[model samples]
Every structure is written in C-alpha cells, then in structure tokens.
Target: MNRNKKNISILGSTGSVGTQTLEVARSYPEAFNVVCLGANKNTQILEDQILEFQPQAISCDYHKELSTRGEIPEKLMSLSEIATYNGVDTVVVATSGNVALIPTFEAIKKGKNIAIANKETIIMAGEQLTSLAESNSVNLMPIDSEPSAIWQCLRGENNHISKLIITASGGPFRNTPVGYLPNVTPANALQHPTWKMGPKISVDSATMMNKAFEVIEARWLFDVPWENIEVIVHPESIIHSMVEFSDGSTKAQLSYPDMMVPIKHALFFPDRAPKSNTTPFDPNKTKSLTFESLDQDKYPCFEIALKIAKRGGTWPSALSGADEA
Candidate 1:
C-alpha cells in the first residue's frame, strides 16, 4: 500500500454499484487503497476482488470458505466492522436497500467520510442519517447518479437553490398502457433501457419507486423540501438531474448514463481525476432530448414515497422491506 493513498472500505463489493466502484478504483490505483471488502452471497467474485485488491478484511453471508491466499483476517468481518474499522479513510456504502443504513451510520459516527449509493437508507432514515453526518462533521457524499448530478449543479451556489428537478429514465414500460402493467413479468420489467442494474432497482425504476426514493434522497442531501422536488421523465437519460435557483436560473449536469461517472466523482470529491469508464455524452447522437411530467396513475409508488418522505418514520423502511420480500 502506498503511504499516501486514501484507504477505503467498500461495503457492497459484489453489487452493481460495488463492481463499478472497483472499476473506478482500478482506474485510479495511485489515488485509492482498498482495505476492506464486503458482499452478501457472491463469494466467488468477492474472493476475486480480495485477491486483486489484497484487502485486509473481507465478508459475505453469515460465513463462507474463501479461496484467497493473502493475509486477510482469519475471521470474516461484518459490514459494520469494516465500516468503522480504524484508519479507514472512507466507507463506500453501496450495499442495496436498508442493509446499508446501520453500517453507514456507524461509519458516520466514527467520523469516516461516506460515499453512498443506497437510496433505501435515505428513504428509511434520511433525517436521522443526515443529522448524524452533520453533527459528526463527516462528509456524506452522494453516489446515486441523480443526486450526484444535483450535487454538482448546486456547487458554489451555497444554499441559493430554490428547486430540484430529478430526471427519470421511465424504465421499459414507459410507453406500455397502464392497463397492461398488472400483467408485466419480472423479466420484462428488468430490461432497463439505459442503465444496467440489479433486479430490485430495475423493478423500482419500472414502478418509479427508484425515482421516488431519489426525490427523498435529494430532499435530504440538499436540504430541500419535498414540495420543491419534482420528477420528470427524460427518455434520453443524457441529463442526469437539474437544480433551479431562487432567481429562476437552472443548472444541470449531463453525462453518459454510466454509474462510473458518479462513483468516481464521489471517490475523488473536491478533486477530479481522469475517467476511464465513462465517455463524454454526445449531443449530436442524442438527437432529440425530451422531458415530460410523470404520469401519477402509471406509477403510484411515487406519491406514496413522497408522503413517506414527509412522514419520516418507519414507513419508508417498511415499504422497502416489503418490496424486497
């Protein structure tokens, strides 16, 4: 390990966001040193990541045999253990759903910087978590593409924002008649047009639950009210998100719909390194960029999530848990 490299522990080292984060780490090896890795059940790739990164700690479901030949801790560490481990500079909380909440708060309480991708954590306890992070003086960087876009747009504005406009890809069934939604199979729903993601999030995108969660996340991350956050369906996905200033000025962040862009942004915040995984978005190829309001009837989850965001209790957690089950 280089003496000057920032040490980071990845909490969901096998998920979509986790793998993309590794790609960012791989591209900028001189800037980051991955010291710990955690996954749920994908031990095969977890072992591969352990070998490649040679992390001091590793973890997976309950317990499992690992095939790595390095000096990893004899006992597998839990996500929280890796999160709050001493000398860890940053904890990348990419674990899906509410699983990330406890470990994320642990890292925050321990004063470790957080780069988070899990929207469920915010939905479940955005108020509490943001307050905890602020009180600890820890940086709670957002890794979700939409929130990251808003973060970039809000830069230098210093709380001068009036509204947040979150963009949605509208999923595979955007054009499908509302009457046919009940018969859509899981396989059909998983086919996201612009982004490749896990099944749960993909399904959430289809139902607009993912956007709903993003609205909640944006509210917490930017300290905006739920009433000020709006969702629009941008089929092209070229524009990730936008922010409107109090004076009617609007700024937006645009990039190719690649998760690596946001992941890398979080990893080297306050600084930017050369990116290998994301290419500049081409407006010529984009042809027609369009936006439309979300059809409430088509995605009832959106309104429900907004209500849960305002309610701010265990309701959001319950909604996510029920979706998982």
Candidate 2:
C-alpha cells in the first residue's frame, strides 16, 4: 500500500516478456506492486507467480477451478477487467497475437498508462490506439527494445525527427545463402544469434518479418512516414536504435540487447532506476560494430509485410492472423 509504488497488471504473466517484467518488479520491490495478472492457460507457472507475487486479482481460463481450491485471490477478473481495474495503475500488454488488443484499448480508454510489448496489436490498429491515447491523456509506452530505444532517444526533444533507424540482429540465417533459406528447419530458424525469444518471434526474426512489423509500429508510435523509417542489419546488437534529427544530428540508445532494460524503463518512465542483473555495455570490450543494408530479395517476407502494412485497414489484422495460424 505504499503511495510511491506503481500498481501493475501484466496480461501475459507466463510468457517470455511477462516473466522478465516480473523479474524487474522483483528486483525493485520498492518501486512496483503486482496488483493483477492475466494469462491464457499456463496454470502451473501462473500458480507459482500467484504464490510469489500475491496479486490482489488474477485473470486466467482456469480461474474458476482454481478458486474452488481456496488459494486463488478473492476476485478473478478477465483481461478487460484487469486493464480497467481501479486498483491498477499501469497495464503491461505482453500477450502475443491479437488477444491483448481489446484489453489494451480498454486500458487506454480508462486512462491507464500502458507498457505494451505486443507488435501485432500496434500493426493492426496503431492509428486508432495512438489517437485514443492522446485524447485520453494516457501514455502508451513501448516495451520492445527497438521502439523503446527510439522512445528513449526522443525523451527531451521537440518534434523535429528526420528519420528513425531501427536495428536488427539479422537472426540466425544472416549468412545463409538465399537459396538455402527455403530448406531451413524450424530448429535452425529458432537459433537466433543474439537474443533469446519466443518461438514465433524467433522464426519471424529469421525472416526479418519482425523488423517489418517494427517498421509499421515505428510509423504509428513516432508519427514518421514509411519512407523515413529504415532498418539495418546490425550483427552485434549493441546499439538498439537511432533517431536522426532535422538538423543533421543523430541520437542513439545503446545497451547489451537485454529486454529487462526496456521493461524497467517503461515501468519507471520519466525517471531511471539503478542497474539490475544486466551487464554494462563496454566499448573497450567490443571489437567492431558493423551495419549492412537489408536485402529485400533475401527477406521477401519483410518486403511483403511492408506492402501489406502500406495497404492498411483490416489487411494487417488478417496478415497477423495468418502468421499466427
């Protein structure tokens, strides 16, 4: 009940980003309070988080059955309920696919600050969502590393951005010949070179489709035109992203490619907390930072995705749904 602590509700408490968000909260117990949690059906991990965090309420498919066991919280809320709950201050939309879209819209409507990691939702309805957030005076903080990097770089600046340079690790098949890509296995695609992520995202990274989604996200998040946003293959992900201003000067955010850094930033915006378990980025240790132009032929999925993004409307929704399927 500390007045200084942020009351948080994580929509995907059992997923990759969700668990890391909890880790950040656990590290800074004085700064955050887990008030609510929502997950699909990962009961075992959800139960463990429930016992550890002891949130005031939770949303899960098995809530009714868990309630009968007597250890569950008194209030079992749905994802929308959790987003608009009076006791919650910020909602973390970490759930994948389109599942978190409605709940995120509800949170914005209720004027709750959102820390969203889901890309599909933004790709689908970024314009509407950003407009609603502006009208409601709510903050839609980005939890993804690229967007977070851009967000950090624009912290104290005026609206004079010239271009947004989103960085990508180029995934596991960066060096693989274009002809060999068709025969790559799922296991091969999942072996991302830099960061560990969920299976779907890993595969998306291999095809550079994740970067394409990010490009669409940046267009809406920063109000930049598609022509102004560019993606580069940075094999070493030491530099998260960069923003070039109209005055010819550029600002970039750098880290060791850790998700916790961005999550912590979103949780405690307008202020920075002390470092957690992530190692500090040392320039002396890194040999050389390299960048390459993204080859459209090598990543046809990325090109096709951007085409679909430009078309707009329900096309993005359908594309994301098809990708999920």
Candidate 3:
C-alpha cells in the first residue's frame, strides 16, 4: 500500500454512485487506495468488486455469502463498523435510503473525511452530521450532482451567498398533465430523459422529490437557510445548480450531465484533475438552456420533503421511510 495514497472505504460499492466512485478511483490509481468496501444484499456484485479493488475489510448485509470469499473477513462487519475501520482515512457513503445515516455518522465521529453520495443521510440528519464533522475536524463532502454544483459555485465567495438555486431535470412526467398523476405507473415514471438511474430515484425524479431532498441537503451542506435555497426545472440538466451572492450576482456550475464530474470534485477537493471519462461543456452543442418553477400540485413529494426539512429532528427519517415504502 502506498503510504501517501488516500485509503478509502466505500459503504455502498455495489450501487451506482459506489461504482462511479470506483471508476474515479480506477482513473487515478496512484491517488487513492481501496482499503474497505461494503454492500447491502448484492452478494454477486460485492464478490466481483472484491476481486477487483481487493479491500482488506468487507461488510455485506448477507454475511453467509460474504463468508465464502476468503479475502473478506470471516466475521463480517456491519456498515457502521467498516466505516470507522482503522485502515480507512476516507469513507464514501454511497448507500441509498436511511441505512447510510448511521455509518456516515460513525465515520464522522471517527474523523474520517466523507464523500457522501446518499442524499437520504443528509436529509435525515444533516444538522447532526455536520455538527459532528465540525467537532471531529473532518470534511463532509457532497457527492450528489446538485449539491456539488452549489458547493462549486460557493468556492472562495467568502460566504456571501444570498441564495442557492438547485436545478431539476423535471423528470419523465414533466409534460404529463396534472390530472394524470394517479395514472402514472412505475414504468412510466422510470423513463428518465437525461440520466440512467435506479428505479426508486427514477420515481423520485419523476415526482421531483429528488430535487426537494436536495433542497434540504443544500440547507445542511452549505449551512444556508431554507429560504435561501431554491429549485428550478432545467430539463437539459446542463446547469447543475446556481448560487447568488449578497452582491446580487448569480453564478452557476455548468457541465455535461455526468456524475463522475462531481464525484471527482469531492474525491479531490480544492484541486481539479484532468477529465478521464467525463465530457466538458461545449457551447456549440448546448444551444439553449431553460428553467421553470415546479408546480406544487404536480409534485406533492417536493412539498412533503420541504415540510419535513422545516420540521427538522426525525421528520426527515419519516420522509425517507415514506419515500422508500
């Protein structure tokens, strides 16, 4: 193991964000070392990732299947345990849903810099986690594209931010009539235009609930008030997010819609590496950019998430559970 390389443990190595984090790690082999990996119930994918990254510690919800792999610890650790494992210097919280909160908190408590892909973790316990990270003197980095965009826009701005404008793709049902919401089947909701994502998130996108969660996430990640955070439907997803300063000027982060861009940004903070697989924004290709306000009636989940965010405490936990169910 290279002494200088960042020793990382991924909490959700089998998921979309986890795989992309690995891709970023794969692109810069000398910069990062995979010290640990965890997965939920995807034993097959977990097994495959183990053969590749070869982490010293492993955690899977299914302990029996993981025991078959001699490389993984026979006494498999839980997500929270692997998160604060001694060898890991950075912990990437990529697990979806409320399950990520505990491990993310545990990692922060241990003073491990965190790259968080799971928005639910922030939505549920952003205040507590941010406070924990501050006390522990560790970084809690956002991996979601919108929050990352807000983060990028706020760079060196001297905390003069007046408002954070988060962008939304408006999802597949953007054009569907409000009267037809009840008719929306799972398959209908899953047809996302710009990004390929998992089913639950796909549904959330269709409902604009994903954007709402981001609103709460931005609130905690940037320590901005609820009124200071806003969302607009930008069907193209070219502009990830925007920030307005007290000086009355707004700056937005634009890139070709790619998760790897933000992933790389969080992994290597305050410094940018050359793009490996991500495409740079081309003005010639992007002729027009449009933004619109979200209709409250069409997307009730957005309102629900915001309501939960404002309520604070364990309300977000309930919101996450309701969304998952």
For this target, which candidate reaches the highest TM-score against the unseen true structure?
2
Q: How many clashes in each candidate? A: 0, 0, 0
Residue-level lDDT tens digits of model 3 in 149-217: 888887787388788899998899889899988888999988999999999999889888888888988
User: Ten-residue segment with the worst summed lDDT in candidate 1?
Assistant: 62-71
lDDT value for model 2: 0.91
Error of 3 at 75 (Å): 6.3
Summarize candidate 2's per-residue lDDT along 25-72 as a digit string, tens digits. 999998999999999878888888888999888999776445333368
**Best candidate, lDDT:** 2
Q: For candidate 1, lDDT tens digit of each residue in 1-325?
A: 4659889999998888899888888888889999889998887788788778888877677445655454456657788999997889889998886787899999999999999998878878888999999999998899988999998897777577788999998999999999998999999989999998888888889889889888888888888877898899999898999998888899999998888888888899888765464688887777788998899999998898677657657777787787777
> Which residue pairs of candidate 3 clash?
none
Which whole-number lDDT from 0 to 100 does residue 83 have in model 3?
Answer: 94
RMSD of each: 1.6, 1.3, 1.6
Clashing pairs in 2: none
TM-score of predicted model 3?
Answer: 0.95
